[model samples]
Target: MLTETGKEYLRYVTEAFDILLLGQQNSRHAAAAPRLMLYTLPSLATKWLLPELHNWRACTPDVDLALHGTHAQFDFNTMHADFVICFGEERYAQLEKKFLFHDEVLPVPSPELIACYQGRKLLSKAPLIHLEWVNERRFLPNWRDWFQAKEIEEPEPQPSFIFNLTLLALHAAVAGAGVILGQRNLIANELASGTLVIVDELSLPHSKPNFLAWPQRTLSQPGSRQPIAWPVELAGTDS
Candidate 1:
């Protein structure tokens, strides 16, 4: 019932539509992979997270992680950050938070240093290493805090080294520089390898917990929460 020209036109129209759909499908498949931008302190990334990244890779093989390290405050919108791992109480009322883990602050010294101070109180005998966080607003337990918790009069020992980052202080302690008020969670690997030892079993629970936070709107997306959950799981395994 149809003329040859009409049949040919119908066939061309169908082919054009099929080609458009195929193009769209190819565009989606060829699109750049999804990336999640995560920000945190340099020490935390290097000491606590870096060692565990292989596990993260096995879990999120398809998602690319962009890790940024800094102590400066960041705007989520301006930085295009998907999430931030922060220490202390929640600061952003608008952001959703997930508790990762709590760490205890304690004195850590190299085995060599401990041997040198055998039978003596290392806190009073050995050189003290200090770590002062750049962001003063978030309080991390220091030697003074530990002493106060133990009800011992705090000493005003002049530190041989003063560092503004945890990683630096940790490395110093490992090099037998001094006894550092180390966070257990951050030095688990070092302790396991007998690189550092806890001094006198003295430790104070950090008043705050480390947490992961992100914009509430991110939850509207399908896979947004996926990246957030793995960190929490990893922290649990570390515990």
Candidate 2:
């Protein structure tokens, strides 16, 4: 019904309008997309976070997650983050702290290490591995502390292997390198699977508690205390 010039003009306008609509849609998607960053210890990442991360995807398909596993505390001053699962008792006084759970440590060793020892005096002979962590708190839970918890004398210094991260110590224990004071809750899977077992039945309660924390100023802080639900979902934790 239109002349050639008018038809061409209408076609041009239609294409332009479509392009603008697409741009608007893309902008809305970009704005609506949620991105979260979390920092946690290597052991917790392997034994806890990673196992449960799939649940988040199933629950909320839109969220993009960035996870960092480390031994030392992350510097929030420079790095932008949503949350952190740190080993301590409210060390960040200014930051809003969500209490996760306290750590329960017991001596754990691989089945191979148990087989290597025929005698009943297993604790005295096995290589004693220790996790050397730089905690903000003064109390350092170690092999001596574990023995003290059982009300027994600390064993003589045996050949020792020390590691900075708990995951490394867990690996060492699994490899039959030594017995490590393992976090029972953290290493529950290993314990359940029979790859690792409690060498000493005594589980010493750590002085400090694990916390899911974020800077008070972070605008994205969820009203719920779950802090990404990294801790509460775990069994035997105070919600």
Candidate 3:
């Protein structure tokens, strides 16, 4: 029983309200899908895992992610990414740290190289592949430290072929380029498949835990999610 003008006004208001509600609902759905940027050490990338990367894909299927991998020496402060997976406690003052997995490093080489260098002084005669950590603090996984840890004296000459990244060193060892101190987890498939063999049973204490780091402030964000359960499950599973 309303006038035509009144009915027209009512119709307009009803349509506007419906549009606003629809927009609100769509915004909420978009917010539910986390759009994240992650920074990680190149070694992790070489191992085919990135920060919050695998768990996000596995656990939160709705999340959208982008990953950046750099040498473990990357400067976290310079990164515009939302999260970083880095080593050591000295970095990330304002972030929460979630320990992922630990790594044990062993000297590895191609079977051919091992056979060729057999019965020789482990360090002096064999070509040692070296991984140079851009960040010195995180680069202790080398022949010198591993040898020292096993109480083997330092060899006369250091490694002749030094690479800036662990993956490079690993590839070199695989190609029979040299002997590399490698992480068991990263090279497990090769070791299992016999593509690479542990030259020495002596493993160094390069066993440091990998961590997921995010700003503490982001913890309360609507899209923020943590892989607390995933890491616990992954810890028991081999890296």
Total backbone collisions for each predicted model: 0, 0, 0
lDDT of 3 by residue, 1-239 (tens): 98999999999999999999999998986777766667777777656464335665778677666667865444446756667776664676557777666677888778888777545554567778877766564646677787777786777785468888778888888998878888876887688889898767887655356777777655655456644344435456423
lDDT winner: 1
lDDT of each: 0.80, 0.75, 0.70
How high a TM-score does candidate 3 get? 0.71
Model 2 scores a C-alpha lDDT of 0.75
lDDT of 2 by residue, 178-225 (tens): 888888777888988999987667777777878877876665543223
| Residue-level lDDT tens digits of model 1 in 114-223 | 98876646777789987776656246777777788888887656556889878888999999999998888889999999999986687777778888889976666445
Model 2 bad stretches (over 4 Å): 1-32, 75-77, 135-138, 217-227, 235-239
Which is the better candidate, 1 or 2, if ranked by lDDT? 1
Cα displacement (angstroms), candidate 2, residue 164, comes to 1.9
Off by over 4 Å in 1: 1-32, 155-159, 220-222, 237-239
Query: Which order, best to worst by TM-score?
Result: 1, 2, 3
Q: Which ten residues in a row have the lowest lDDT in candidate 1?
A: 26-35
TM-score of 1: 0.80
Residue 96 in model 2: lDDT = 70
